[model samples]
Target: MAKVIMTCGNLCSGKSTYAEKLGKELRAVVLSIDELMTTVLGRELGDMHDEYVRRCEQYLYKKAAETALAGTDVIIDWGFWKKAQRGYAREFFRQQGIDCEFHYIAVSNEEWERRIAARNAEVLNGRSDVYHIDSGLLEKFRTMFEEPDRQEMDMWIE
Candidate 1:
């Protein structure tokens, strides 16, 4: 049976990269909010960004369920930043009668800083389509991300 693979991590933790490789390995469709938001919405949402993210997530959730129900595995390449969010994702799949796995990508501060610098450089060079993590944005995410316990994860990648 097909399943949903949800990735959990902080910003710049390589969830998207992992999902791409996993999708190829598992023959799953990868769904990404950043891809959608960047290609469609751009950076002008400002204060409404959070609200847009909420709606975008809902849409992705629906599509993921549908794809999984159709017997195609799906990978959600988003930072399931909070435990509650992780719980909600699991419950959502449970209610859909679809199995799901939580894959957490744990990164050290040094590696995360390195990734942020690399990604920001790509964004500055117009080579990447994701949000640039400024110091303020980094601080905001630092406070927002609630790391999951080991027991909550089905797979842990360091």
Candidate 2:
């Protein structure tokens, strides 16, 4: 039986890196919205970015289930910032009769800021396709992200 590993974290919390390593260890398929969005749409969605992300996530959720059912473990490299989003993912897999684990990557404010700078440099240097977190974008996500309680996570990575 295959399992689903869902990553829960804020922006630049190293979820993608963690998922990639875990995917390799588990022989799982890693699905990421940022990878999909940036590869297909190329970063200039503007006001439509949120809508595009929602659609992409829906598609990935279906794909994850399909891959899991085919006996391959799946890693969802997503920032399940809201509790509702995490809950929905758990229930979605539960109803599918697939085991699911939520791995939360917790980072301090100092570390997060440092990571933002590093990631921004990488993006600006054309070395990475990930989104660059501007002040406005940072503030938006900071206000939007609802930190998950410890009990809600199956694994916690600092």
Candidate 3:
């Protein structure tokens, strides 16, 4: 049975890195919202960033369902930060008669901060396609992200 693996984590929590590894291990296609947004929108969406991300996520969710229905596994690297979002994803796949698994990547604050700094440096050096996180953006993401409890996740990577 094909399945959708959803990644839950905060910024710089290594969601994309883990998704890449898991996708290869599971022989799944990795659908990354960040890659989609950055490739199409040039790494920055400004004031409409959230709205744009929401739209992209909707599209990806539909595509993931289609792919899974075709008997191919998919790994969504969107950082499903909120419990409601995770619930919706689970139900969406359930309604399609597809299996879904939630994987949460847990990172300590110190490590997360260090990773963010390194990522920012990579972006600055033009060595990565990811967006740099400033103080304001970091705070915004911190406030927006909702940590998931153990029961909400099928797998945990710390």
Candidate 4:
């Protein structure tokens, strides 16, 4: 049976990197919300992206359930930065009876800054579309994220 593994972290915290590696390690289908949003809309979401992101996230989670039913593991790389969102997700997965777990990669502010700088250079050179977010934005999310503690999720990556 296929299971769902979700990775959540602030921007530049290497969420995608870990998801990709885990997907390959588990032989699962990696579903990236950012990449999918761009593909579906033909552009990266703008400043008012919360609504679109929420909708797309719902779509992908539903798709993950469907994918699991089809007998393929699904790995979701994204962050649910709100308590309601996290609650909804847990309920949704429970309803679908899909095995689900959440992982978090803890990174120091200094390390995040370094990665952001590195990613910014790549973006500037057109070698990557991955954007480097501002430190303030990450700090805001750190406070906002519902934060799946070990008790809230099936598993929590320390």
- Best of the candidates, lDDT: 1
TM-score for each model: 0.96, 0.96, 0.96, 0.85
Q: Which pairs clash (backbone N, Cα, C closer than 3 Å) in model 1?
A: none
Cα-lDDT of candidate 3:
0.91
Tell me which of candidates 1 and 4 scores higher on lDDT: 1
Alpha carbon lDDT of each predicted model: 0.94, 0.93, 0.91, 0.78
For model 4, how does the per-residue alpha-carbon lDDT over 53-148 read when each residue is reduced to its tens digit?
878888898899999889999989887656576677777887988877777766777886788788878978999876555667657755775555
In angstroms, give how far residue 11 of model 1 lies from its true place: 0.6
Tens-digit lDDT track for model 3 on 1-158?
Answer: 89999999998898999999999998999999988998888765779988998999999999999999999999999888888898899999999999999999999989988998999999899998777889998998889999998998999889
- Cα error, residue 53 of model 4, in Å, equals 0.6
By TM-score, is 1 or 4 better? 1
Q: Where is model 1 poorest over a 10-residue stretch in terms of lDDT?
A: 36-45
Residue pairs clashing, model 3:
none
| Residue 22 in candidate 2, Cα distance off native in Å | 0.3
Q: What is the lDDT of candidate 2?
A: 0.93
The residue-by-residue lDDT of candidate 2 on 8-90, one tens digit each, is 99998999999999999998999998899989988899899899999999999999999999999999999998999998998
TM-score of candidate 3 versus the correct structure, residues matched by position: 0.96
How well does candidate 3 score on lDDT at residue 13?
92
